[model samples]
Target: MSDASFSLNGTHPTVNWLGQVRAPGTPGSLPLIRQTVVEAAETCGFCDEDVAKIEMAVGEACTNIIEHSYSTQPLNLDIEVKVGRYDNRLEVTILDYSSINFAVDQMAAVPLDDYIATGRRRGLGLFIIQSFVDKVEHRFVCGQGNELKLTKFFA
Candidate 1:
């Protein structure tokens, strides 16, 4: 775990506080990531319900990286989660170092009504994440890694 304060681009506000956690990209690491995010959100003055929502959203994002992004690789890569507190929102960025570059735009929306009616149990990670967070952004660089940013505005 680490903490820092830094300014982003001119268009964005400077992050008031930032903390990060890195763990192996495995199911076992999800709890640690979720707990760290929850603690950060609470410290940022998020309400109980909002903190729960952020927790779930970050969990889903990390799960996708572990299950999909690192699925093909044999070794366990590290997943870096950065929690940043801005003036209006709490942002959690999940980074995976896998070589796989997933198409975030190409992820098809799940038909919630049909999905629930069919009694399906899986494939709703993205939906849950989008529904919980105020904003979601994905970026990937060839040599760098894929970063999924989830933000929840303070109410």
Candidate 2:
């Protein structure tokens, strides 16, 4: 079964991505995730440049979900990737029923001397997502989940 499917929501096209994976491993589902996401992005009529950005951003997003979200046990992960073209822009949104478990803030800012000393990679996913997209917005839903949106303006 595929995690994503295309449907028409009024005038625009939509992709509903849904699936789950254990923390220990993503199984063979990882490829499917990439394929579906890439296809949806392509559907937005992105050129080579956009493709490169999508490659990185999508990989990072999927990796984050696989590593942080549900524990090793089989946990439900519902991901929705919607792509649309309007006003010469491609907008992509990734919605997941997951949470950020790592010390993101500490790692990102390097406020502590220790963090600076360690020089550990931080905000890699978020930074890449922000860099690749024109804009990003995130919101947390108490019981439902969280949403991370990325948009790109194309010529």
Candidate 3:
């Protein structure tokens, strides 16, 4: 599904947009979702630098979802990318069917020096999302799915 849904929430109708992209859990589908997110952020008046940050963070999150959550069935899984704008923030909610419980508090940021010295590349997506966005809310409904809400506030 590549259709976009629009809605206004406590903001000007013309300034708010919501788009959804559904794809199989694979790396190849990331660019399309990333582009959709970046375009939505741009429409919210985000500068180039901020838009790039949002793109990078969203890309990392999507990658993690596909890599970790759907490792067994990456090509057959359902992944959804929801992009929206409201007030002074641009938000993106990524919904996935994976039932893994995410612990935000336990996913602390590693020191730059330690990460560089170790040269290890794992468990960094959540950190990137936390650092790039002003607010993050995660919800896992018993029967529905996991919702990762990322919000980047305008400066």
Q: Pick the candidate with the highest TM-score.
A: 1
Model 2 steric clash total: 0
lDDT, candidate 3, 1-155, per-residue tens: 23344455835443344577998878999989998898888777888988888998889878877877778643477889888766667778888888675544247777667777998877667667778788778888765667888889878
What TM-score does structure 2 among the candidates reach? 0.61
lDDT for each candidate structure = 0.84, 0.58, 0.77
- Cα RMSD to the true fold for all candidates: 2.1, 6.2, 3.6
Ranked by TM-score, top first:
1, 3, 2
Tens digits of per-residue lDDT for model 2, 1-155: 25455667676555444332222225345566556556756766678677778757756765666667645425666555555455556655656665543322223422445555787866467566656767666666766665666667765
Extract clashing residue pairs from model 1.
none
* Poorest lDDT segment (10 consecutive residues) of candidate 2: 16-25
Instruction: Flag regions of model 2 displaced more than 4 Å.
Output: 1-27, 72-74, 99-123
> For every model shown, what is its TM-score relative to the native structure?
0.89, 0.61, 0.82
Question: What is the lDDT, from 0 to 100, of the residue 105 in candidate 3?
Answer: 29
- lDDT at 63 for candidate 3? 89
Segments of candidate 1 deviating more than 4 angstroms: 1-4, 8-12
The candidate maximizing lDDT is 1
